[model samples]
Each structure stands twice: as C-alpha cells, then as structure tokens.
Target chain A: MNDVIITAIQQTLIEGNVETAETAARAALEAGVDAQTILNEGLMRGADIVGQQFEAGEVFLPQLMFTARALKAAMAIITPELKRLSAESGISSSKGRVVLATIQSDIHDIGKNIVSTMLTTGGFEVIDLGVDVPIKRIISTALDEGADIIGCSAMLTTSMPFMSDLIKTLEAMGQRERFKVMIGGASVTPAYAERIGADGTAANAVQALQLARQFMQNALA
Target chain B: MDYLEIIDRSDSGEYISEENWDLEKVAMTCMRLVSQYDLKWDRQNLVPDDPALADRVFAAGLALAVEIGAYNRSSERILRFERDELESALRDMKQTLSMGQGADERVLFARQIEDSRPPLVWAGNPGAPHPEALFLPAVVSWAQEPIVDLITCGTLAEVDGREVRTGEALEITATRRELTYLHQALAHVGRPGMGMLAAQSSVSELGDLAAANPDYLRTCDAHLVPMLNELKIDNRNIARAVNSIEYGMRNGGLYCAISGGLGGDAPGCALISVASMILGLLTNRADYHILHPIHIRHVATSTREVLWVESVVLQAFARNAPAIIVTDVYPKSGALTRELLYETAANALAITVSGGHLEGCGSADGLVPHATGLEPRLMGEVGHAACRQGVTRAQANQWILQLMEKYEHVFRMPEGNPGARFDQAYDLETLQPLPEWTRMYEEVKTELKEMGLDLSG
Candidate 1:
C-alpha cells in the first residue's frame, strides 16, 4: 500500500523477478486499494522509473528483470479490480487491443516480452502469444481477438522469412487490412523491414510503443 | 579504475603521445583471454613437426581455424533463431542424416526448413574487400554458394600518426582509392556493385598494401608483427587501430563497413581472434561498418570446451555490435568429409545467421603438408553461395542441422585411404580436386539448389 510497492516494483523491474513482485502485488490488493489506482499509480510509475534507470545505465539486465517481475505481479492483482471498477462505474472507451507474438520457428521471446510490457504500460490491451508461433495460429489469434494491431517478432536472420510468409498468409486470408502489423528484433534493419513489407517496424521497445499509438491514430483519422 | 583507466595512465591520463600511436587495448586483453582459455599462442604449429603435445595442440587449433573460419561465419540476430520451432527443426534434420551428432560444427540456413528460403547468405565468413570497384566481379564471383559481400571501403593506414578516424582526411582518401580500385577491379570482374560494406585499415599504409607485391603484403601481414605487438592494448592503441580501420575505409570508402583487423593478437597470444573483433567495435565506429572475428578454437574433441567458450563470447558480442558479424566457417578436423563439410558449413551458418552476418571462409584445409591439394577455390565457391542466402537466421541455422545429420559422427575422424599421408583434408599447396571430388562439388551445388537455395543466380 505504501512506497514499498513502488520501491519493490522498481527493484523487481531491473532484477527481472516475477515471484517476489507478485507477492508485493497480492499484498497491495489485500490492502483495499482500487485496482486501477495500483496499476497507474504504483505499477506503471515503478516501470517508468526503471525505464529511466535503464536509459541512464544506473541499472542493467538483471535489474530490468526484477522490474518486469514486479510490474507483472502488480498488473496481476489490478486486472480483476480494474474490470470490476469499470463495471461498477459503467465506464467505456478503453485503449485498443494489440496481439503480440514472436513469429513461429524462432524461440527468442525476450524482445517480444519487453515490447509487450511497454505496450501494457501504454494502457493498450496486449495479448502476448509467446515465442516460436506458427503463422496460422497468429493470424487466427488476431482475427479471434479482434486485434487492431498485430506485432510479429523475429530475432534471427534465418527466421525472417517467417515474417514475410506471415504477412502473405494474412493477405491470403483477407485479414491483412483488418490489422496493422509491426515487426522488430536486433538483426532487423529498417531496410529489411521495408523490404519484407511490414506496415511498421520498431527498433526497440520505446519505439514500438510510439509507432503503435501512431498507427491506431492514423487508422482513426 | 577499470582496465581502460589503467591504460590511460600510460598516456599520462591524457591523449596518446605521438611516440605511442597504434597500440591496442584489445591486444592487452588477449593475454588474459589466453590464460583463461589455456590455449597455445602460435600459428606456426599449424602443422606439427614433432610428437610434442603442444605442437599437436597448435596444429589442432590451426585445424579448428579452418573449421571456424571456413565454416560460414555469422553471429548476429541470434534472438530470431532462439525459438523452439527452429531448435526442433534442427533436431529433426539432424535425425534424418545418420551422421549428425557432434559439438564441432554444422550448417544452418534457418531455424526451420519451413522458414529457410534462399538468396540469403546467413553465414559465410565473407570477404568485404575495400574499394567498391570490385563489385561487378566481386558480386559475380560471390554469386557462388558461400561468398556473401564486398565491403567496398573502410579505414585507411595513418593520418598525422593519430590513426585518422572519422574525419574529412579519411573520407577523401577512401573515395579516391575506391574510385581507383572499383574502376579496375570491376572492369576485370565485369559487374556493378550491388552490396557494399565499410572499408577499414590504416591510410598511412595505403602506399604499403598498394605495394601488394607479395613480398610487401607478406611483410605487412607477417614481418611487421613485432612492432604491432609493441603498442600494447590501450585506448590509444584502440584509437590507433580504429584510425587504421578508418584509413582502410578511406582507401575503400563509401562501401559501408564496420572496422577491425586480424592483428589484434598480443604479439603471441592464443586469443587474438576475439581481441581483434572487440577492439573494432569499442571504437564507436558503428556507423561506418561492423567487425567481429571470433576467436579460433581447436578441432580436437578433447577441446570442445574451449570452442564453446569462444562461441559464448561471440554470442555476447552478437548482441553488442550492430555491423555484420563474421565467424570461422570450417570444422578444423583433418577427418572432414564432403558431407561433413556441408554439414559443418550448415551448422556454422546456423550460428552465424542467428548470431550475426557470417563470413563463409571456406576455411578448407590448407597449411598442413599433406592437407594440401584440398581445393581452396571450392571453399570460396561454397562461401559465395552460402552468403547470398538472405534467409532468416533460424532457417539458415536449420541448414546446419541438416549438415550435422551427415557429419557430426566424423568430428573426430571419418574415412581415409590406406596410404593417406594426412588424416582427412589436405593442406593449401596440395589443394586440388580429383575428378570425383569435382563431381561431388557439382552434385552438392545442384542438390542445394533443389532445396530452394537458388545458388545459380
């Protein structure tokens, strides 16, 4: 209920711990705090601080892991509470939905996970499909979830063909225009993304969030 | 203070004095790497003359140099290949070929065959020669299986002894040299430049390698070894090395490159390979190009642990640098077979494409007295074709899985004639393909193309 949640979240993000952060979140929820309040005020605020630390190099990968764990734990407790609050308030108009998955044939899930966390912090509904996903399942999931944006992750040069093939599959299924596509990973160059024909490609997590928001806005316009 | 800080003291914690230009911090770090890895530090023992285990060990390491070097270099984009689908695909591919099962090498064009299409060289310790002029022939010649790119230009030799990097002086020289070389090299090769990489080297040595009179090159590459070692690894040395790369780029400017060289070894150190690459990246010359030369590991099955250590270091490096990654492409064992060669190339390709841009060295056997007569050109041919794959790292890696299927069992030894002078592959001087071997090369090429590799282009 106190800054302990905030400090713990901060510590957890960098250290990549999911367990202890989960404990902290459960405790925060038991403290009678509103779910939305913990999410925006406690969880997200903690992630933002950790993001800056990473930016400043005050902390590195180990610290970021802990931070992610803390955030995930806090988000777990707040999801139900937020739903309940929305129902109680009879509110509407939340952020759009995003389907995030690491493409099939590639098991590199770290980049996708980081991007998913960033998208969640942006308040978008992120549905992460994990790594090494087949093209068919991704297309099916996007259609079923009614996702507005589809983010495909590939970290291998060998696996890049999957990205192109996934797009081709979406096009074949007549669902290509239904969702915006985003591609990313370390070996992914802008030239490659353009060559492969993804609607958008981000270099890193921060860039992913910016592009995602922009894509949705453009669609609306 | 850290190591850099400690090195800074040599320069009085200021700039490198004019007297101490061209030293390298990477070379300094080489000492520690050798001690840690417990590897021998000489290339001469490439062929042991005695029964000494140390001599044999050096020969083993040299053999590995061919394995790693000629094996289809790559080590960037590792994340893409780190998937279950890719891993499973390789597992399945290895199972298909009865010979697959070894820690030494394999070819990989992708994480999965489903993802493995062609026109992409995922891993080929490719040549990125400076001077864009080499493009037409470079590309044409490179159209073969393993050769991948032609880095048009990079850093030059020297500028006011400060090892000129990132300035107008470097640019002027690079552009001029590139124009001169491109016009001539292309004229002979007959192709326009398609893909170019950054040039790297000392501009001061422009007049030197231009003196590529075999005698001069031999001197620069070998004789000047002692002086290069004297500069000890430090920031100034790093700067000098960076500047020299800048000079190499200048000589072959506008070709696109990430700078580094082969001399990053401590005068006599076993870890020269890693040191050379680390020095190249630390210079903040990411914009121009990228350079990474994976440390060599011995081919001896007894030394598998040593090889892994080098691989892990390269894995870390793959995440750190942005430029294309180049690693060894051969397996290093004298017992290598054509099938095993393909498999090792495939495995090395898998690691390279996933990890980074690979250089397919065709590091086919050479240097040994009997290891001769094994065609180095075929090695180059495989390199050129494999490099053009452009497939995903995981898919490219799958090719290694395919190769391991046929070659892993032979990592230690395979087959040989009763009167064989050497164990398996031959040395450089004797590198010639018997008609049967030539036919085998043709057969492999056709088969790879059938797999959708599209090497004919």
Candidate 2:
C-alpha cells in the first residue's frame, strides 16, 4: 500500500501536477511512509527523470520548471515531517546547501533560475538571491545560512569582475576556505574561472550539478 | 497610445508576481496559442515556404501580444495593450528610413520574401568583446569593407588597460571612447558618413545617456533597446528609448527569443518573436527591429532550430505587417576556421531569402573576442549572391542543410567551436585578414559556389 502511494507521488511529480503531487504526499504521510523514503524513492526519482530528460533535449525549460514546482509543492508538505524526524534522531537530511545569485549589474536571471531549480530537484537546499545581487549580500547570506557552496552567474562582461571581487572579499575576511565557489553564465569562460580562482565552472545546468556534487565530495574528503 | 501612457500602464496595470508571469502568463499562454493555431515545427523544413502558416503564426502572435502584453520588471505589472493599439502601431510603422549622411547614406526598406533587391549589408562583430587596442582596427575593418552599406561594432572589454565596470565613471569613459574610436575608424576608412548601430558599451542607460552627444552617437546612427527574455522590459531600456526618441536618434528593438525557453521549439519561438516585435513597435518606439533568436542551449542564432525560428518570424512579419527587419548572423564558430564561414553562409542564405537584412558575424557565439572583418565580408557576399541568384526558400534550405552538415558537429563538442581570436586572424597594422584566414574564406567561397550560390556577381 505504501509502495502504491509512493508511486502515485512519483507519477504526479513527473506529470508536473502540482495539486495532485501535494495530495499524493499527504496520502503517503497519512499512510505512514517515512518522509525520507518518500523523498528519496518518489520526489527525487521524478526529478532525476525530468533532469535527465532536460539534459537529453527531450524536454525544455518549461517542463523542468513545472517539475520543479511540483517538487516544491511536495517538499513543502514533507519538510516539517522530515524536520521532526531529524530532531528525534539528530540526523540532518540534505545533499548540501547552495546559495545562488546573478552578480551585480546583471539583471539576467534565466540561467541562474534554471540552475536554482536543478539544484533544488537534485536534492540540494538552494537559497536563490535573485538577479543584480551584490557580492556583500551574497556573502552575508551564505554566512548566515552556513551554505556549502556559492554559485555566481553573470551574463554581462561588466558584471564578471564582481565574481573576482567576491573571491577577494572572502579571502580578505578569511572565509575563502569555508565554501566552494563556482562561476558560470554566457560570458564566463573556464579561463575566466581559473583567473578569478573559482573552484570550478560548468557549461550548462547538468554539468553544474555534477560540478557542485564534486565540490561537495572534495569538501568531505 | 502615448508613450507616457505605456509608462503609466506599467505602473498601474494588473499585478502578477514575476514567477507567475514567467511560467503561467508567458509560458502557458504561448503553449495554448501554439496548439490553438495548429502550429508545428517541421525539423526537415527549416525554411517553410507556406504563406498560410505564416499568417497563422501572425494571428497567434497578435493574440499573444494582447493577452500577456509586456511585463514591467520594475513594477511587476503587465503593460496591457488593446489589439487595435498594437495593430495601429504596426500599421503606422516606418516602411522606409534613411540612415547615415552624404554619399554613405542608404535607405532601409521592408523586404518581401525573396525580394529581388540586394539586402543592405550591416556588417560588424556586434556585442562581442574586444580589447582596447583592437577596438579601433576592428571597427575600421568592417567600415572599410566596400560591400558593407552600414556598420556596427563590439563592446570594449577594457579602457586604458583597466577593466570596465558597469554603473561606474568608467562606463561613461568606455562609451565615449567607443564612439570616438568608431568615428575615427570610419573617417580613417574614408567612409566618415557611414551609419552605425553602436553604443554597445552601454551596459545600462548611463553609458547610452553619456553617448548621446553629436560627437558620439549621432542622430544618424542607431542604438539597441533590448527586450529581456520572453516579453519583459525594464527601466534601463525604457530610458534608452526615451533618450533616443527625444534626442532624435534611431532605436532598434532587439528581441532575442530563446528557442527552448518560455516558448518551446521553433514554432513557439517564432510566435514569441512576432509578439515581441509587435510590443516593441509601441514600447521601444523602434524605427526597425533585429531578429536575433538564439538557441537556449547553444546561445547561437545559426543553429537549424534558430534559423527556422528566424525564417518563420521574418516571413510572418513580411506577409502580415511589413517592417524593416535585420537578422543578426551570430555563428558558433569563429575566424580562421571553415566552420565559421559555413555557419555565416547558412545564416545569410536563410535570413536574406526570408526577408531579413544582414547584421553580423558575431562569431564564436558572441562570447569571445574571436571575430574579425573577413566573416562579415563573407556574410555580405553570401547574402548578395543569394539575392542575385534569386534563390527561393527551397533552394536556400537545401544549401543551408549542406552548410549545416559541415559545421553542426561543433555544437556538440564540449570545447564549443572557439576557432581563433581577432589578433590571430587579422594583421594589426594593415587591418587585413591573415593568409591562413583568407585561404579558409576562399576555400569556403569555392565550396559555396559549387553548391549553386552565384558568387561571381
């Protein structure tokens, strides 16, 4: 019966049916399925399928966004239950926390938003600072939230210098060793990433996920 | 509708959060219209020769424009428009406009599908980044091309060896220096009266406002007022339009609809492109339009899907409401490579035959400073040759397919076709193509001729 409810939740998420996804999560919870099992076996599975479809070019941004929305809906219901379980057992359940922003003076956020959605669905806790975000605010927020990584996006060449400034500021504050910094966007090249001392850069959202995961692994190591 | 009314509506119109506006209003509405209009993108037919399909796309686009309108990012409101207002704006648009002064002056006109007249060649490495040292010679390269009727240029990556940061004092300096170099380059090339689409140094309204002097961006030259992704606009571009309109300079509404973004696939992107153009007619008060549909993944306009989107959008406007449309020829590959020439040729053939004047060689996808004058020269040659041969949509499609086969592999590569930088491709002193680059151009020209383009003329 629990397996049936979990499959329903997964199917609803894959179909991007927000209301049904929420209702399915409620049903799973009422049926006594643990929050972690529902998340890992159902929501994450659906998101993984959607992400794969997006990477394969079988689906596009809208589908990815809709699926992410469905995941958000389901996560909203399951988060408190998972928090309760975490408090009881003293175990944290998250891949890693990522703070994302489009650098200052760059109002382009489509790429950043896409990355945020992918990170959320890929099991990372994402705090999106939105576009035209100042480096100071991004650093303060990441420090406040204890984020594991900072992903900065800049589509304009003028805004790219701020990424360097972000690293410099972190180093000045003696916090460069605390978080992994990744940079990307239309104008950001791998060479620019190396020049600015970014931990890594990715060409697209799929690769961005891989890069972020690698950063987390290296952090653990 | 008054321009002030557009601004007032932006403040007072129906409110929707930006997220809801993007997904529900823009994306869902586009998907509904795509189905309602029975529009389907045929991958095999990148340049569809169907007039009825074009008309359907225009109707769907007009409906979309009325439904969603333009979202104001500042106010988070929809700048709603009545169908009559949009129609009136399109009807009253300038059918012909003259650019430049004296012997260099040229008249831009609305082009019909397969129009016999040779399309005006507006050449440049538009929006690409260039070091300060290369800026002057790069502009001169495009200006000196005898086949180029007008010119455009890239932005300066630096000023006096210092990096340019937006919203700073250096923005003003960079913008002014850009125009000064442009002016000097045109005069140095003996085409002092040549018109330009410039002010690329303007990352915001600050640089544009600073460059409004006659010595900088003249009334004769034009500047871009870009619409954000999908159907969104902000105060920065609004300020640019207001400044240019009051200052008497021309405004080119730049709509770069992402192929796989809000609008899905080629047909949906065409729909969004048409709607954006209609809104731009009122919002930007544009004298002309630049169709620059880029792939969401590749970010280049020369892809097969983007070419199809460009063809359909241009055809829709040409058939329904004729306007002066210039297609940006941003290819994936850069200079010193046959792939760049092939991409340029395919883009030129597709756009020129589909009622779009040429403006590009934003090579290497406009990311690197990997562009030079030779690619724009090839763009003009291919565009004029296609017109001279009177190639039909079918013939252009066939040639484009052959050309795509030669370069499409690069898009799949991880390194992404970063061919060669400007300094490596051209001689700094003479501002001429290097030997190897010229050889690649000649070889590509020969191959294109064998494919039935009349290059001899």
- Against the correct fold, how does model 1 do in TM-score? 0.37
Q: What is each candidate's fraction of native interface contacts (fnat)?
A: 0.00, 0.68
What TM-score would chain A of each candidate receive against the reference chain A?
A: 0.76, 0.95
- Per-residue alpha-carbon lDDT of model 1 for B1-457, expressed as tens digits? 1224223333343343211121122222333334444444322212111223333323322222222211100111001111242223223321111100122112222221112222123222222222232222322233222333332222222333332222225534443453344335333443333233222232223333343332212111110110122112323223433443333321110111111111222222223333323222221222221222222112221122222322333343333322233333434332233653454345344433334333333232211112212322333344345556555434443454455455455533432111122223332233334455456657766766666664565
Which candidate number has the best TM-score?
A: 2
On the 0 to 100 scale, the lDDT of residue A6 in model 1 is 54
Candidate 2: tens digits of C-alpha lDDT, residues A1-221: 88888888888878888999999999899989999999999999989998998888788788889999999999999999999999999877788999999998999998998899899889899999888899999999999999999999998898899899999999999999999999999988888899999999998898899999898878778
Error of 1 at B265 (Å): 23
User: What would the per-residue lDDT of candidate 2 be over residues B142-239, giving only the tens digit for each residue?
Assistant: 78989999998899879998999888888899999999999999899899898889989888889999999999999999999988988999877888
Once superposed on the true structure, which residue ranges of model 1 sit more than 4 Å away at CA? A1-19, A56-58, A90-96, A104-110, A120-126, A130-132, A155-162, A186-197, A216-221, B1-136, B139-457
CAPRI grade, predicted model 1: incorrect
Instruction: Please give the RMSD of candidate 1 to the true structure.
Output: 25.4
My TM-score estimates for the predictions, one after another, are 0.37, 0.98
DockQ of each: 0.01, 0.79
